[model samples]
Target: MENKTTILSLFLIFLFTLPFSAQESYFPPEGEWETKEATAYQLDFAEAIEFAQDNEYSESRDLRQAILKGFQSEPYHKILGPTKKRGGPAGIIIKNGYIVAEWGDTERVDMTFSVTKSFLSTTALLALQQNLITDVNDKAGNYLWDDTFEGPHNSKITWKHLLEQNSDWSGELWGSYDWADRPPSDKNIDEWRERELHEPGTYFKYNDVRVNVLAYSLLNVFRKPLPKVLKEEIMDPIGASTKWRWYGYKDSWTTIDGLKMQSVSGGGHSGGGMFINTRDMARFGLLFMNNGKWEGNQLISEELIKEAVQPSKANTNYGYMWWLNADGPRQWENIDENIFYAAGFGGNFIIVDQKNNLVIVTRWLQPSKIEEFMQILYKNI
Candidate 1:
C-alpha cells in the first residue's frame, strides 16, 4: 500500500510537470507571440500578368495557374524531382502587396539561407532609425570588443562595409567544404570581428561573419539582446509573429565566471538560419510596401525603408540585406532599375516592383538549373 501511494504521487507530480515542460521554449525569457488565425487577402492572380494591358496586375489567379503549369512543365523545377536533387519547391509571387501566384509547395517553410541577410539588414536599419546607433559608418571596434589579429579589420570595417559585402574579415563566406562552410557561431562574434584582416571597404567578398558582427554591434549598442530588440521593434509590430522565431539552440544565453558562456545569438548574412512560412514572408513584403508602418505604427522610417530596398552602397545592387540587380546577364532585363529583391538559397526570392506596387516571393528546392529556372520564371512573369 505504501509503495502504491508513492508511485501514484510520482505520477501526479509528472502530470503537473509535463505541462510546464511542454510550455517551455528554448527562445529564452521573452513574451509569447500571441497567436491568431491568418486572414487571406483577395488578389487577382492571372489577368495582370499574362495580359500586359492590365498593368495593375489584376488577374492574380490566372498568374497563379501559369506558375503552377510552369512548375509542372519546367524541366528545371522537375516537379517530381527527388528531395536532395532539387533546390526546394513552390514559387511564391506577391503582386501589389498581395499573394497573386504560387508554384510548387503551398506556403512550405524552407531554410532562407542568405535572405536572412536581408532581414538582418532590416534590423540594422531599425537600429539606426531608433537612434540606438548614430552612424552606419561607425567602426566595428567602437561597439565590438578588441582583439590583436582582428583589430585592423575591425578599425577600418564599418557597419556599411559589412552591409555592402565589402568587409576584409570575410576570408571565406560562401561555397562548400571551405572556410565558408563553417559560419561564425553566435559565440565569439566579437572575437571573429576582431580577427586579423586587411583594410575594410577594400573588396566585395560575400562574408557571412560580417552580419554576425552587425548583430553583436546592435546588441551592444542597445545593451540588450538583438532578438528581443528585433521582436519589439520589427517583428511583432509588422505581424510577422507566425513564422518569425529567433534561433538560439538551448540555454541560449547564460554566464559562467563573468564570461560569455553563450557567445553568439544567430546566423549572419550570406547565410542565416531563418525558417518562416510563405505567408509571413509575403506579409513582410507588405510591411515594406506600406512604408514600414504596420497598423499605423511607424516601425521603420519611410526614408530608411526606401534606402533599405534601393541600392545605396555598391554598384552590385545590394541594399541593406536586399539584392537589387538590374538585368545582370539574366533573363529579367525588362525590370526597371528601381526593382529590388531579396534572394535566398534553393531559389527563393522576395521581389519588390516599386513601380507596379508589387512584391513577389518564390521559395523552392529545384536542382537542375536553379539560376536559369528562376530567371526564366521572372522573365515569363
Candidate 2:
C-alpha cells in the first residue's frame, strides 16, 4: 500500500512539472482548428476584444479608394494588382496553438498589404538554407548578372540589405521607378528624381519599387514562381489552406528556365501582395511562435528565424522584414522588447509573443490603437 502511494505521488508531480507547451501544444490541421476557453488559462480578454471592436480602422472598406487616398502625395502612384474590399475588424488570439478568442469574420480573405514582406523574406531564408545562394552578404548582382543589379550603387546591394530595406537600390522595376515611391513631401518630382543616393546598408527607406526588386531578384534565384516555392516549402507543410494567393503587378512577368512566371511583390502598396484569411495568418504566427517548427519538422532553420528577428543597424525596430518592438518610435511602451510582428496597410497585424507563447492576429483594428490593445491583452495574459 505504501509503495502504491509513493508511485502515485511521483506521477502527479511529473504531470504537474511538465512544461505547458509540452503538455498542451497543438498544431491545427488543415480546415480545422481547436478552441479552448480563455478562462481555462486564467485569462479574461473580453476588454481587449471590446477595445479592438470599438477601434476598427477608419479607412474605407473599399481598399481601392483607401489605397489611392493614402498615397496621393506620391507621383504616378497607381494600383497595378488586385485589391479586395476589406472585412470589418477581425482577430484571433491563440495560446499554445489553440484559439482562445476570436471576433468578426476570421474566415474572410482580405488583402494583407506589406505583411507579405514577412513571407517574401521567408523565401530568401529558405534559399539560404537550401544552399541555392551561398551567403546573404554576397553581392546580389552575382546571383543574376542581368542589368537589375548593374550600376555602382545597385551592384553594391546585397540580399541582407534588401531584406532589411536599406538597399537604396536605384532604377525602375515593372514600370515603377524607385524614386517615385514614397517621395518626400518637401521635394518636387524632379528634385526627388535627382536626389542623391545613399550607400546600400547605410539608410533605411520603405519603398515598394525597391521591395519589388527584392521579389524580382528572388524570382531569378528560385527560377520559379515564389507562390509555388512558398506553397511547397512552407504553406502546405504547415497545413495552410488553398485559398491564400500571392499577387504581383499585372505586367510583372519574366521568363525563367524557358517558362514565364510572375515576380510577386513584397507588399500591396501598389496593389500586389498577399490576400489571406485571419485563421491562416494565425497558423503562420503559430509557426513562428514555435520557432519555425511544424510538428517536429524544421521547415525553416531555427538559427535563421533567430537571425530574422534581430534588429538591423539601420532600424532598431525593424528586422529582416519583421517589425521589432525594440526601443524605437514604433516601440510599444511597457511591452516586451522582444515582441515582433508583421504589419501591413489597413491595420493588418500578425503579432508573435514568444515569451508568452502567444500568437495574435488582428485585422482592421485601428492602427493607432494597437499598442493599447496589446497592453490590454497582455494585462489579461
Best TM-score among the predictions, by candidate number: 2
Provide the TM-score for each candidate, comma-separated.
Answer: 0.63, 0.96
Tens digit of per-residue lDDT, candidate 1, span 1-381: 999999999988887776321333111112222221112323344432232211221212222232334333222221111011222345556444334465455455545556666677777887788776678777656665534115434467777777777665543211211123233555353555455554566555564445555655555566665566667777666656454545432333434345553223233122224666666666677677667766557788899887666544344566676776554432245456667777754445676665555566655533234344344444534
Off by over 4 Å in 1: 1-88, 103-107, 148-150, 170-198, 248-272, 310-314, 327-331, 365-381
Task: Mark the regions of model 2 whose C-alpha exceeds 4 Å error after superposition.
Answer: 1-18
How many Å off is the CA of 191 in candidate 2?
2.1
Deviation (Å) of 331 in candidate 1: 8.3
lDDT of 2 by residue, 136-230 (tens): 89999999958999977888999999999999998999999999999988889999898999988889999889888999999999999999999
RMSD of each: 18.5, 2.1
Question: What's the lDDT for candidate 1?
Answer: 0.52
Give the Cα error of residue 246 in candidate 2, in Å: 0.5
C-alpha lDDT of residue 30 in model 1: 24
